[model samples]
Target: MIPTPYPLEEALGIGWYITDTPGTGGVLRKSPEDFAVEEIPLQEPSGSGPYLICRLQKRNWEHQHAMKTIASALGISHRRIAWAGTKDKNAVTSQYISIYGVEEAAVEELRIKDIVVRPVGRNQHPLSLGLLEGNRFAITIRDCTAADTAATVAACTAAAAVGFPNYFGLQRFGVVRPVTHLVGRHILQGDYEAAVMTYVALACPDEDEEVRRIRTEYRETLDAKAAIAALPRHLGFERSLLSRLAEAPEDHAGALKNLPPKLLSMFVSAYQSWLFNRVLSMRLADGVGLDDPVSGDRLLFENGREDLVTETNRRLVSVHLSRGRCAIAVFIPGSEGARIEGKSDERMAMILEEDGITAEDFKRAADFVGLRYNGALRPIAVKSEIQSGVLETDVSLAFTLPPGHYATTVCREFMKADPRAMI
Candidate 1:
């Protein structure tokens, strides 16, 4: 349950530090050449290890698509290939992919469309999620004037000194079609039929005209079989879900189960992300300091440690915050071991009360689709290392951010354009 039925648009419209900073209005990801990312490995790979880590550069490839391609070339199942993070489809990105029980020579020989693989080294363990320290981004903002570049540089410099708000970027929910949170809400409420319709029939304006028309037809006719036939082959998720519905219209949960478990879990995570964004917005609106700690706030340090804030410990926490070694943290609500309590607890409770839900509601979601709520603390603001230089008509900016932080969150402050359009 949420106070409001997952307001997708409002959740995305979070605040920024330099609200009036003139934007370097330009296009990002105009081509694969425009945006680039390099994954920063957690540590140097051991020369003698069980896993082969391949450094790959891919152009215009979705994360899962790239995995499947690599898996096919390596003669292994997709699950055998693991990555640190999922890169965007619209960018030219470089990252390390690990394959267990694969030879170094075979990995070096593997090639896939739009992917360049180099055998970097080997590691003793698979590159699990959040294994990377951060990502290095070299993004080009096209068609910008000197003034635009100056504004962007100033924002970046200021952010380097004073951390920026850590709102989850638009991509976390959805960029093209912002309905992941909506579908998640329906599923959490145990309305599987609503979830199916939200995933399959809700046409988004941001999508292409043909896509909108197809979704519109499906919503109007309630004909799953016809809709599945009309949808393009690339829309495999939609096709499979609709095909299930066609066979048994009442089997909503079964239809949803047709999607990959990881992808299905993303819907639940999207909803949690939306709630955090909403609460973050409220806190900003209330004039709370983005990086400053208050009594009852939870303070997290860089050494993977945290302390409860109180009058007795506020001074110690302030010292850490001043040194840029710690930050005030907030929680994404979950059951038992997941939920956090302190200053932010009141805010979380208020939101839960407004939504007519308790923390216990999240526990019930696990009963359907294994949507377990694994909660964690996230900083309200994060420090970034930014280096910007202008070249001809384009402004190139390079920066590194911690794992789980969104680079777009920092860029949006400078660009002030549609975050989705930029990516």
Candidate 2:
């Protein structure tokens, strides 16, 4: 059994149960010698409509930040720009973006020094939200040590045989006030407090009574009773805050709107939470985690080697992004073969003998909220080492998982980790 120690929120950070299927392959790997040495200059699209485009450097630029820079150069609202996906801030990312209501003549005028206007294409429809199937990451992992090469080969070979989970990256759930971003959005849009509260509730369904009650009644009730009860008596002062907020709805929401754009995005995310949870719950019911597309072993084939085909073996990730189609980089943690099982962290969970919520209830909620959830197995290739010592072993695993699944569930024995999140 998994120890399931950490708060479900924090536990999600360590690993991912791949959530979606790759339109193409999942792992794209190549050695330095195999890497193509040329840069392809993106062609300027001639048509007029909406297009998302960017030529970003390998470092020092977050996705939205880079877009703002490009927008300033072109004299357009940042809101009008769209991207298929976000790239890591530390890597060189040349990706396509969508621009709405821009003229063809203005395309060439938009330029930034290090940023290249990679490619531009017109679409009749603005790219809708969450429209991307997968992100094609073209990355170069540097700072490899002499010892890293052998491990890299082994990891790559393992991936060739097994696939990693397609989990939502760690950054999905923001730190500390995870739902703060969502709350901010709802307040500014003049949304009901209940809607916002529902959003926070979905984030960590298994959150304690104190946390849940405080979040839901944050603007409706304030007496310090709930907060004091939730924590130690010393924290009694926090209870009055919820009542105070209920007294200042217009003022409070207005105050949130006055905050920065990032905060604003988070606020909107909260309003979206109810939907996120509802959908997530429904996807789980369908068993997407143990089913097709996302639940198979994935691999890549060199230009000439095409003997292997997709097959089922127990439960393994089965997908491959072609060599030139996608970039595959393995994230090798400091420890390899580190196993986990049982009570892992700060969060506490008590198995409810009674059904708190049922599958049928989840379906009704999903339809009402418009949220989607898919779980799957998550696998990691690691080299284990005790702190201040050398590695004990290097183990690379190809994980086959269904949607809404986590690979850590398999590593529970070694890491003693748990399924604390997904509440």
Candidate 3:
């Protein structure tokens, strides 16, 4: 079997590849047009309502930065803008956004380089995260090194028909610095000082050399004022944290609180995601199959209902699975109301025990951050109807996945190269 790159992939708990065929080694996102994403909205906007919905098409723009820029042009708070999902910065993406108390004319008049906004309709309520049905992706992998790209693509496509592990992709953690989970772990442990420091001072080799040097210096000095002056203006979030600490150096928790609530909450959620990845990988290493549920597994139905598999109903569950009724799910632990039964839960508990964390820690983090971590179930595997084409040395793939799934997760199975190349 093809193995994932060491250190980074192994650290993320993505240990193995399902297909044994050689990967069509390639680089992705050579340009913005190479990776395209279009949102499939769940509900269309009505013609008359309080909130004006618009279609946003952007290239080479980070999600939060693009929203903030639009909000500035509209003379409204960035909080007034909402979207169904966050798109990649270095890609051509089209999605819908809702602007509160704005007219179609205002949106039509606004303009920005490499960004287009067109009014779609109006809705009674504003869009919220995960409001879309899913996303459609058209991605091209260029400069492939494989001798027979068609054979490699065919092998991966056939294996993907059964399903692949649903590990959260690299984007969940910061692609450049992969330290969101580290900050999250400190937050859950109630060590706000470490959380703040980790966010501000942790350096990654993938980042610019000057930025890395500055972060390393700050890590050594712990002088927020000096670091604030040294940090570039583009590093706004880091500056915001340091600005707070520069005044009251002991106020680590308060500095963390200065961050947007959604972003702050994401830190803790990333930790939960890391734990889920570990459990999923461990299950795979044990030789568990993804096509059907075995005894002591939790089966998640499409309608959000869950049932446990037992010897009595394993056959029935298998039949329903074949009919696309439900899928095997692994529990993502939370502070409260989380399912703690089944082999998956046992593995999760074992990991938590080894890490010296407990359910109570998550509860405390929720209380501190003013966000709820009530737990949820995620499918262990996901399947898609993939369409692929190979042109000379480049291969293109088109597929749609349910909301909260990552396209890179599918791409990785085909590339089998360094995660950095995919980014």
Pairs of colliding residues, candidate 1:
none
Kindly list the per-residue Cα lDDT of model 2 for residues 1-423, writing each as its tens digit. Answer: 011234543334332322221111112112321111112223444455455343334243555667677777778886677654444343344455667776656766655655566445666555433444432222222222223444443433333233332333223443223454344233433453443343433324545556655555533553334433554332222323333344564443333333334434533333233233223323334444322333212222333331212335322323333213221211111101111111110011111012232233323333333432221112222112111111232222333322222233222222222232110
Per-residue C-alpha lDDT of model 1 across residues 200-259, encoded as one tens digit per residue: 999987788887899999999989999988898877788889999999988989999988
Decide which is better by lDDT, 1 or 3: 3
TM-score on alpha carbons, each prediction: 0.88, 0.41, 0.96
Prediction-by-prediction clash tally: 0, 80, 0
Over 339-384, each residue of candidate 3 has an lDDT whose tens digit, in order, gives: 5677889888887788777889988999888888888889988789
Alpha-carbon RMSD to native, per candidate: 3.8, 14.3, 1.6
User: Which residue pairs in model 3 clash with each other?
Assistant: none
Ranking by lDDT: 3, 1, 2
Off by over 4 Å in 3: none
Q: Is candidate 1 or candidate 2 better by TM-score?
A: 1
| Residue runs of model 2 more than 4 Å from their true location after superposition | 1-10, 13-59, 111-113, 129-133, 138-152, 174-250, 255-423
Best by TM-score: 3
